[model samples]
Target: MNIPSLPPPVTRDKNALVLFSGGQDSTTCLAWALTHYNHVETVGFSYGQRHAVELEGRPRILEKLRQFSEKWNRRLGADHIVDLSLISHLSETAMTTEMEIRVMENGLPNTFVPGRNLMFLTAAAMLAYRRDLNTLVGGMCETDFSGYPDCRDDAVKALQVALNIGMDTRLALLTPLMWKNKKETWQMAFDLGGQKLIELIVSETHTCYIGEHNRLHEWGYGCGKCPACLLRKRGFMEYQSEKKPI
Candidate 1:
């Protein structure tokens, strides 16, 4: 299948504003940016997550950013972590706090953060306008995400269009992992920086919405039953076994 093309690049600097979430996908994108783009700056949100445990690891994520930054030096600019908790005020979703993310009996997982991608992208757009960045590297995906509606390709395209009009300037949104499952995503991490990134991510990156920090259940912080954990296990198995789908 032909992957959808991003809008043509506009800014001369070719600087990127990444919607980083301190997860496997975003970290890989951050690494990908270092090898691909002329410049890349990241932006993360703290919008009252159901599990604030990851919030505590934001500094570590930034340090990961610095590890890459020291290599690129002046080419890599500042990595910004925005505190956009006001966004949760717009919606009362379970991702906003400890609302006991419920399973809908026979439907998608309850950890879905509605409008999360929309809000994140919009915030990136606003930041990009200030930086005059032409490209936005967003890691949101339907491939192996939290099953949020806004993570769909259609939603991304719509946001691209709306953001262009809203900013009165063209912005090309690049999704490096939109077509890859978790294993492929993890492999991309390995490819970009070898096994080190994967080990660091598995050890540091937090994906649990239920707020499990201690006890070291299985792979990382999350319980093994949740979708995120199941996907993590599957991906880690595929990575270790060399049976990656992609």
Candidate 2:
């Protein structure tokens, strides 16, 4: 999971709207944006997914984040939770539907929801236009993606282009984790807010696809076998191992 560091963090003079999901990656992205953006707001969706309960923890996560840094929270806007149940109805994937989680011949898994990311980015862009924001941030990553076509770097780049052209506005789509692995993702959270932010992410963020939170793994509370949980635990373990004293 070792990878080169990103060139540099972008400093945005304008506000940033994050496509948050109250999950590990999105929380990390939110923190990342807070460190760089002058003003930051989060937007999440209630798409009737299996893990819809994850949305329940958004407010608490924000509260803790706000408490962590008043300077960052001063410009934080309210979380915009959109009702996107139609997205769930339109998709027949495991994430939004009851289906076996298996990788298909096309390299996509049952968790892959076609056009979900596109729809999300489009919605976030529209919201950004209304808010006069110039940036849309997401936590999508290709390095440790779980067979999701939408999470690919190429797809995200192409969608950004199409979104800008369709909206007739110049909006920068920033995927901070685009080239980073899960281990690097953990490290980024640590680098951004030190140990406090890392603790918040580990204890508060929800990344379990099946919504299991009782049992705690090294990464956090999850079933530990689902794709999401496995990736998180492995990344966390790698991050810890790499950070250990020689």
Candidate 3:
């Protein structure tokens, strides 16, 4: 999709911000930012959704990443979790409401939270503006997403433009996973560093809609039935298959 380009690249001196949820994709994006940017901070959102447990995992993920930074001699900035529970009250979908998951007439799943990504990017951009940061990173993947309109590259591009104009600041919003699938996402985390980053992602992140982390799987621990868990497991299987010796 042809979308608007971002603001000019900033100097390497400025910090980069990642819109973190401590989920699979976001974790990979965080690791990607850590590799490319010298200074990286994470910002999470608590919207009172059914899977709010993911928010709690943010710190754990950051802690593990910080340990990796120490070993790898990299620098990490502070992590912040913002309270946006009002967003939950604003939408009634499977993510925030007690309803069965189904595909809407527009081909979107019930888990689709209207403007969630838009709000997240906008909030992250504002935070970056105040912190004197020139880049914002996120993990929105349209290829392996649950039909979220906001996850589309075009949508994010439009929002990036709107945010720059509204905030009157030049910021580049980067989606490292924009063109990647779930399997590619796993490969990305591994390629960014090594197997240790992949292990941290599986052991420290949460992606289940039902918040089931006790059950173990090749990808991670999840309920094994929800959309998130299914996609993760499938990706892990594909990744393993590709890595197998013929």
Candidate 4:
């Protein structure tokens, strides 16, 4: 089905609180925020995981994100980075444990941390409410990856309704890549001109929840056997093929 494009700039205020994980989708969402909002700030959660190495890559990702932020900050925005790491102990899932990550066999994958997006978005809305910003951008997608229930559109809309009623604020949960697959997501990031988008995504973000943070190569660190590594490898290859000369 074709969804007609809404009016130009369906947003009310340019201020937004982005749920950044320093990954491809979130990073791409950050780039999208630069083009849409007047003020955008990012919040990254350092959830305890076997692959704590991804957290180590945050500073580098922030440097790049900050650069992107500067361009739009001068025009319609500014950006900031915030840390929220206290909830790692409260969650129970394969992502925060030493247990091996299982493939998606029973609908959702094991790496789907329970209530992650809901909790994150709710937290972000609090910050958004404080700033009186009605726009909130998250990096959750239901395409070609973990089928976490929280990443679905219904969940997002439900949460949005709850958020507004709870705080009496109308916050729009904008997901530019929700309907897109990983292949299209890569291309969007490329067109956004992240300079090293392919490289940045392939080498920077930590998808492997395992403790193998030391592994590095043409496609960053991963166990190479997990669901995430496999999906990423497939996407990277597709992205490369898409860019190659015919």
| TM-scores for every predicted model | 0.87, 0.92, 0.94, 0.83
lDDT of each: 0.74, 0.84, 0.84, 0.70
Candidate 4 regions with alpha-carbon error over 4 angstroms: 1-13, 68-70, 73-87, 103-107, 244-246
> lDDT of model 1 at residue 81?
70
Better of 2 and 3 by lDDT: 2
Off by over 4 Å in 1: 1-6, 68-70, 243-246
Query: lDDT by residue for model 1 over 174-201, one digit each (tens)?
Result: 8888888987887788888776667677
Model 4 global lDDT (CA atoms, 0 to 1): 0.70
TM-score, cand. 3 vs. native: 0.94
Pitting candidate 1 against candidate 3, the one with the higher TM-score is 3
Displacement of residue 107 (Cα, Å) in model 2 is: 3.0
Candidate 2 vs candidate 4: the TM-score winner is 2
Output the lDDT of residue 72, model 2: 80
Question: Which parts of model 2 are misplaced by more than 4 Å?
Answer: 1-13, 244-246
lDDT of 3 at 196: 91
User: Which residue pairs clash within candidate 2?
Assistant: none
